[model samples]
Target: MFNWNLIGSIILPNIGGWAGAITTAGQMKNENGTAWYQTLEKPSWNPPNWLFGPAWTVLYCGMGFASYLVWRDCGGFTKKSILPLVLYGGQLVLNWTWTPVFFRLHQIGLALIHIFLLDAAAAACTASFIAVNKNTAYFMVPYLAWLCFATTLNYSIWQLNKDDGENYK
Candidate 1:
């Protein structure tokens, strides 16, 4: 039989993982000259938007599982629990902030800065999680890879559309 309480404890954080991705996706919007992102000069390697959702979904689930393992391995709520949770939550919040800054506010340049910070936060968080649970750290590998791709994409976007200002305030 499965431990219902154990499963429940991790459920909220797992949902947060999903929520972070969905929140970002919800912020995307299209424009007249291009389909939101279609007008932007993406690198040749840019993956389609559809790929992002599924990828993030899987990654977040992995993250939740990793965190759960850490929580379980430790005394449920120790300094260890707080460490990974704080780091993970911090990065997740930063993750959620990127899309609004980029798409909603039309601030790709600012978003670039935000994404860079988000990347660093995730790295720091990953390292901290590793101290508590190696699997937790490993779960973030996909997130790290995606962030690297995103950093390039963000920089490219900022460069491609500089000075236009378009709808930007």
Candidate 2:
């Protein structure tokens, strides 16, 4: 009656989300809320700094639920399950690293590249998940949309401040 598998589907993706969030928090130990990010020449369309936390929370939960659906449909991590899950895991790592790449290291150009790859990986993950469950693939749509916005933002910031150098710290 406890429904451990059901709990796992909810908990597992949140764990992945938390891992990325915690790693980003650690990486941004000295950067978050500091002038470093605030001082950037962001685009006019850039959302306020306060918006990111909530946005990511929703996105992460959706991601977890989607992954769970795929995992359940695929009958766990068999050979059939490997590709989609691996792609999901890979994109998650890239997702976590982008914040540090941009905020901690102040490497806008490199961060742009990372995000582009992240976008691709996420898209592939979604496509792969479709074979397992339509809902799983649908769940990734918002994340992919967010990534498109983020990619544009990153590129704009990079272009805007390319001459500023890495003096952001």
Candidate 3:
């Protein structure tokens, strides 16, 4: 059996993440590694711009796969499935919102808040996924780790730029 629903489950979250990236590409292109970001006071440890695309691609794939496992184990849309799915969806929305908040709106402080909430949501989603399947839960670990690192980066950016008064505000 092809299991089209299972296929959809595996594909949709990745697609959503990809689409979100595409939709925000213009802002990212404008802000990333450009004079604006370069002018900002950032930590020396901040990742090079080249790393983000590949890292996000892997993370998005993991998200989709993890969601698929939860969907498969819980047999879709039932009471057992709702919590994990909801948590997954919630974190996805938060994930999608971060780029725009940071890049487009140029709100580093708000972006830091969003990323922290995103980290919390992702952690909760992972825990819920564990109740359904351990492998699925494991799949989210790297994403969670990345979010933790990203949160630190975001916080550092906000702190470093807080006195810039003219740029961020």
Candidate 4:
């Protein structure tokens, strides 16, 4: 018998992650010739543009699997599961919103702030997951590490271009 619930639980976060990626990709297409993201002054340590999709794909899968573990351990949204799941959902929403704010709206500063909140929410989610399953919490560690890197990158971009009026461009 196929475990549909397990499959769905894993797919849910990937859907949200890919939806955001697709939406941001569409927005990038509207940039005519000079892509706004490429024009930004990123940090020297920033990864190449081509790397983001693959990196995000892996992160999303890990996060989705982590959520499934949590759900499985707590018996699918029982009272014991409520807090961690809510934290997970909240961080997911924050995760989805960051791309649009940074890429579409060109609000680098706002995106930095948003990512800070996401970092906190993800940390809380990981802690809650640890209570449910230590192995599940391990899955979130990479995502958390990536988020830290991303936050530093965002802050760097914001600082590097704060006076350039690139946010408006």
Task: Find the candidate with the highest lDDT and give its number.
Answer: 4
TM-score on alpha carbons, each prediction: 0.81, 0.85, 0.87, 0.93
Query: What would the per-residue lDDT of candidate 1 be over residues 62-154, giving only the tens digit for each residue?
Result: 666776776788778787578777887898788767766776566788888899999999998888778887777667788798899889988
Candidate 3 residue pairs that clash: none
Clashes, model 2: 0
Listed per model in order, the count of residue pairs whose N, CA or C atoms clash below 3 Å is: 1, 0, 0, 0
Write the residue-wise lDDT of candidate 4 on 1-169 in tens digits.
9888777877777887788788677644554765777777778999977798888888888888888898999999899999999999999999988998888788998998899999999999999998999998668999999999999999999998998974632
Off by over 4 Å in 2: 12-34, 167-169
In model 1, how large is the Cα lDDT of residue 58?
Answer: 74
- Pick the winner on lDDT between candidates 1 and 4: 4
Report, for every candidate in turn, its global Cα lDDT versus the true structure.
Answer: 0.73, 0.79, 0.82, 0.86
- Sort every candidate by lDDT, greatest first: 4, 3, 2, 1
Tell me, by TM-score, which candidate is best.
4
Segments of candidate 4 deviating more than 4 angstroms: 26-32
RMSD to the true structure for each prediction, in A, is 3.1, 3.0, 2.5, 1.8
* Rank list by TM-score: 4, 3, 2, 1
Which residue pairs show collisions in model 1? 30-36
